[model samples]
Target: AFTVDVKSVANKQIPCHPEQKMLDAFLRRGEWIPNSCNQGTCGTCKVKVLSGTVAHPPTPDSVLSYQEQEEGFVLTCQSVPTSDVVIAVPAADKPSSTGHLLRDMTATVLQMQTTATDTLTISVGIDEPLEFSAGQYVELAIPGTNDVRQYSMANPPSQSNVLEFHIRRQPGGLATDAWIFDSLTAGDAINLTGPWGDFVYDDDDDETGMILLAGGTGLAPLKSIALHALTVNPQREIHLYHGVRRSADLYDVEFWESLARNYSGVRYVPCVSREHWSGRTGYVGDAMLADFDSCRNYSGYLCGPPAMVDAGVKAFKRKRMSARRIRREKYTPAP
Candidate 1:
């Protein structure tokens, strides 16, 4: 076991096994570290190593640069402490003495529909309503199995007992194959917990316009945030960029189109790649870059696969967007 000294939280010390991830150790000790994808793709759990070496798994090049690695910046979610170390975590990531409350509730599947060829939308009704912030996710455990998968809520909190999720089916996936594809059905009971996530909308930031970027089913959380934003502040300037590989994958286009047509404060830009579509092509980031010369006045929210989120970050940075004004969540395959 290796000792990890966290410099930001009153110099707390935690024990970490070489085989365990540093983030897991922090979490086990109820220490909060900003993280999204536990697989190390999001770059949210990054911390500065003050005086130690860490052994890490193979991280995507886009998540951490070589220079960052050399400078002792490590991704806690993917790295294991090789020796006793001192690390400095950002103040924003410090957990409260009382951590966020987590609840486990029983939900009965209300309906399941295919929104797109590869995307499934499932609505569940919980016996007791779950109070959660916008842009949070819940874990659904497969009945009669140890398998559990996390999916963000597509519906806003106003929906109360009714929660919705958009899931992109992965062929032969453990959860998909056993439950999501065939075994699960309407009225079936499923175990759920959460409302967990840091990618949340800040209602206090009324003056700063929001730029929401989403890819594929990553639209789930962004949709929740957008709707909540509209409800909270209808006059707020919010732009949504939804990207998909093909035109066929553009689910919820009609809803967004209606919003764009009727709401002056809301704008929807959908982009398609890997196909010739009359709409914007190439990448969603290209559309975002073309829409604004500078992002200094805007707050950014990004949720998607690592590649898409990373590209969006680079594009926003080129437009002089402050890193502090941007929040992100990256999606990766369930571990």
Candidate 2:
């Protein structure tokens, strides 16, 4: 057995079995670690190895570049401690705010529909009530692969028994592809653990207008936030920009348009990147820039691929937006 000196903003020592992944070990001990895409592709699980040795399985080069690895950064999801290890994690923004609460849920698949070629709109209903703020996600573990995939909850907290997921079927995604295209059916029972993620709606900041950016399936969490905002404050003057490759790729466009029509304050803009697109044709970031000349006073929430999130953050910074005002969650493809 190995010992771990886990130091985050909390500064605590946690021990783990030598064979356990750092994240699993932390969760087992009731410690929270911010993570998505447990397959080591998303950088959300990044941590600094302050000391001691670790044995990390080979990870995709896209996950951590040469410079990051040289700097002693490792994906805790893929790293196993060989000896006592010391790690440093970024402090939680809200210390008192606990990360997503954990609970075992046996949900029955209520509805499943394909939104795009690879995206699915899956609705599941739990036997008991569950509460989670907008922009939180849950983990669905598949039996055979022992792989846990995280999908953001698309429904609002007010919808206690229903859980919605906008899942994109990765080419060989063990859990999602099987559930969406091939195997899962209505009435099927699936295990879920969640409401994970620190990205939540800020009800306190009512005066600050929100700029939401979504790319592909990243729209899941943003949808939840939009739904919640509509439910509470319908006149918030929020701007939502969703990016897709083709016009057909614009899943749930009618729903968004309906929201925009119903709520006079909400504006929905869809951007298409590929050809054969007559409507706003450009990258989502570019569309955002064209629509809003200045982001000086706005609060921005972005969720999507790492590339899109990274570019959006830089663009916002260039437009005089403060880092504190911009919140983002980057989704990394599973390796």
Candidate 3:
């Protein structure tokens, strides 16, 4: 066993087994560490090793670079300490509420709005009340099959028993194909488990600006974050960038525009990649750089395909945004 010291305002000492990952140790102690994809793919659990040696397998190049590895950066989800260690974890240092526990619940589809040709906005009424943060997700079990898919909630916490999601129809996707095209309809019942994930608003620092980046159906969670932020911190600077392929693919433009008008600090910028339009045209990464002078003072929340998230992270880093300040929730396919 080793003693792990997390250097923060109220420092904590955790007992860790040689074979256990640091995140597991902290979680066992009821200490929260912002993490997603415990398998080490997301890079959300990264912390600087102030004084320690840890052993870990090679991380994905997209998540951790050679330069980061050389700088004593370790993914807490993947690394096991070799000795008593001291590390700096920003999320651990910040004040956070007690975490939510996973729950099993049944829900009935309330409504389905066709947001775009390929995207559907779904609202479901939960059988039991659920309390979840804006950027969290749930594992949805598709009826008549063993397939289960994950989707982030698009509604605010105020809607306790009702949940909303933005789902995109995929050509061969098992769950999406059924939900969007064939079987799903209002009054259909589905089993789900969660209120999972930690991609939430950081009440820890209201002064820091918030930047939300979304792509395709990835806009679901970001929309929740933006709306919640508006209600909670009206004065906080929020920049939202939604990237899609074409003008027809864009949805909820009026909502964002109206939001910006009401909230002086909120700025909504939509980027289109494929076709030229009167609005911003290009990659979302390029649009972000073009829209803002610097990301050095902002806290970034990214949710999208891995490629889009990777590009945004690189751009944010180049603009001097610290890894600790950038929080990400990836929307990948369910296994």
Candidate 4:
């Protein structure tokens, strides 16, 4: 095994097999760097190779240009070490004593239900204790293959061992149609690696009110955030809006209503776009524009399709909200 050196890490040296990805080796040793998408599509895991050789795989020119590759920059997620190497971790990824480390877990499917017209609510029980921020996600391994899919945790982090996810059906998705929907069942064992993401609420940002906007199953992470936020400060005013094409496509309305019933500061608004209903009917961004004239002291958390997230950001900006206070995660259908 070759030794990989991370300049930012105090350990200085870590073992890495020739066939293993550098990031996987680092994470296995409790060393973490700033990362979002682990598939190399997002350049969040890119780092400067101070001194080392790696078998870098083909990546999108848009994400890792040839010029950058020549300059010893590589996406650690896909780069495999060839020999002893030294890499510079990004400055933002300061090691945290209390942060959750990447874990490989074997879980038994505890429950599964169709939460909406195209969404499935799944619960899996892991034998080991898991710790994660409220709005983080996990990667589910596809049996008999190396493929893995990312899904946000729907349940709050307090429910650590048993993770919940709201998965939307992608008509031709291998993970959904072929595996999760077609074959997965209660009691089935599955492999997963997790506790990834940065779109979470923290007490440090408790000064502003919250505007949680979600589209379709994007409500998962926001639900976790809201639940944790209320736990930290119940009286913190929160406006949560879920936008879907029709009422049938909506799920968890009752859950949100229950939160509102118990917590006086919780406001749940269900929005229907293509169907007429006795409730709010329009795009989520438009609904937010109608509800709040000025989001001066409000923090926005939006998740969904890219268009919806972009529109939500635009609406929030229009309401005089600052860009730094807006957090969003975009979901793309598996291809």
Candidate whose lDDT is highest: 4
Query: Cα lDDT of all candidates, in order?
Result: 0.83, 0.81, 0.82, 0.86
Residues 141-240, candidate 1: write the lDDT tens digits.
8777866798999898888799999988887788876569867789888898675567777665667899999999999999998888888888879899
Kindly report which residue pairs in candidate 1 clash with one another. none
- Decoy 3 TM-score against native: 0.75
lDDT of 4: 0.86
TM-score (all chains, Cα) for each model: 0.77, 0.80, 0.75, 0.93
What lDDT does candidate 1 reach at residue 31? 62
Worst 10 residues of 2 by lDDT: 92-101
Model 2, residue 187: C-alpha shift (Å): 1.1
Query: Candidate 3 lDDT, tens digit per residue, 1-335?
Result: 99889886366888899998898787656567777676677787898899978899988778988888888889998899999999888554432442565567899999999888688889999866787777888878887786667888988777778999888888778888756567788998889877656777667656789888898888888888788777877887998899999988898888889989999999989999999999998878888887777888898989988899999999898888878888777777653
Residue 162 alpha-carbon offset, candidate 4, angstroms: 1.2
Q: Tell me which of candidates 3 and 4 scores higher on TM-score.
A: 4
CA shift of 20, model 3, Å = 18
Clashing residue pairs in candidate 4 (N, C-alpha, C atoms within 3 angstroms): none
Question: Which regions of candidate 2 deviate over 4 angstroms?
Answer: 1-22, 25-30, 34-37, 41-92, 95-98, 176-179, 202-204
